[model samples]
Target: MTEISKISLRNLQKRFGEKVVLNGVDLDIAPGDSMVVIGSSGTGKSVMLKCILGLLRPDGGTIQLDGNDIGTLRQRERNALLRHVGMLFQGGALFDSLPVWENVSFGLLGAGGISRRDAKDHAIETLAKVELDAPTADLYPAELSGGMQKRVGLARAIAASPDIIFFDEPTTGLDPITADVINNLILERVQELGATTLTITHDMASVGKIASRVAMLHDGKIIWSGNASDIDRSDNPYLNQFIHGEAIGPMRPDVSTTMPKETY
Candidate 1:
């Protein structure tokens, strides 16, 4: 039997009609590994993340979580598997209607992980871990600044103490300093949890700070992967063009792939 990874995607394929978003993608994330996938605006980074999270069904391939093939897991089994996962969406996708405490504890409250009476307290505690104070917990998502919203989202993601955390563009829409701040918080929290992480971002600064291993995705495949420190020294023309942000290179701008994602 092939040894299992903490999370593995083998021959993963996804397409929107004829648009091949992910083509035979192969990647493995081991336990407690901080793996970052870097790519330009599109190239199916989000699509790949969605596939692992079971939000989208792949046209072909398998995603295994802790040695178990996710495609084969029953609905209840899948739900149980998902309980160990946490996600911080790119946009701090919080419910505007829910206050910070409720937002932070949303999963715990909804998933029967915490009692109603204790949920608020747990949320407050989690918020503190991200350097969000108790009072901020009373505000709605709309009331907070972009950075605060990100912190609250981080608080929510870590509230359940998930074994695996996914960070989607963790520093998006922030000033450079704020982005750095969020990156630091993410690094601290990931280390504190000793949890495995899969981060998808184009931000090089975030990559420098958060990645234990960095993978470059282009044309729906990982073109290169190595220690984060080695990215600048890579000889691959595609990788060199990408990391240096050069216009004239082998990589033609993938106009076919849009900013958010491929259209349905």
Candidate 2:
């Protein structure tokens, strides 16, 4: 039997003036499934994510969560919908002004049933799940190393045990070893929570580690997708070019404006 989708996007369309970013995109994410969307930079992967998260209103298309179109939700309803979602942004977008514990428990603290003391304790527990030390919780984001910052972000993302989690380039600037560690933590935490996850990244190592299913977004639409194991063997030219990091491929990146002029 086919599984019902927890999140669905159909014929999603978005544009900025004359430039179209996401054109008729479509995707479905099953409950508890870790789906990673992969593509080169400037391919609308981030824009598509923003559309699903309601950070940006789409020009056209339907975004459904648990079978209800999110676009139709009133402000109050939308706020309720957001309560079930968590996001770990690229660059570990932690508030520098807040202490580590406060950052981790930001969502819980804002909801208001729990006392600050209890929130701190809960934050520490969540930090431990991400392999972060108790002492680290006292330090500010600026005091911690890059890897530690990512861990803190992960702790925040899972603090409320959200039903749906979104990871934006979870390993953007980390070294290989550190990136691998983050990937393992992501897998462990998501499995423990049984949460559905959507991640956008070009890091193939991360894709191999955390994704159960992989989809390729190209020309503002999903051109291909399949089981994670099939990624290496897929014969699609775009897939091969991206996974192999080949310069000579069907994808012609626009370097005309960005490339530096030659100098003697």
TM-score of each: 0.95, 0.94
What is candidate 1's CA lDDT for residue 154?
91
Cα lDDT tens digits for candidate 1, 41-99: 87889999999998889989898888889899999999888878899999999999989
* Model 1 misplaced stretches (Cα beyond 4 Å): 1-4, 256-264
Give the best candidate by lDDT.
2
The TM-score of predicted model 1 comes to 0.95
Q: Which candidate is the best by TM-score?
A: 1
- Candidate 1: residue pairs that collide: none
User: Model 2 over residues 11-104: C-alpha lDDT tens digits?
Assistant: 9998876678889988999998899999988888888888888888999999998777999999888877887888999989999999999999
lDDT of 1: 0.89
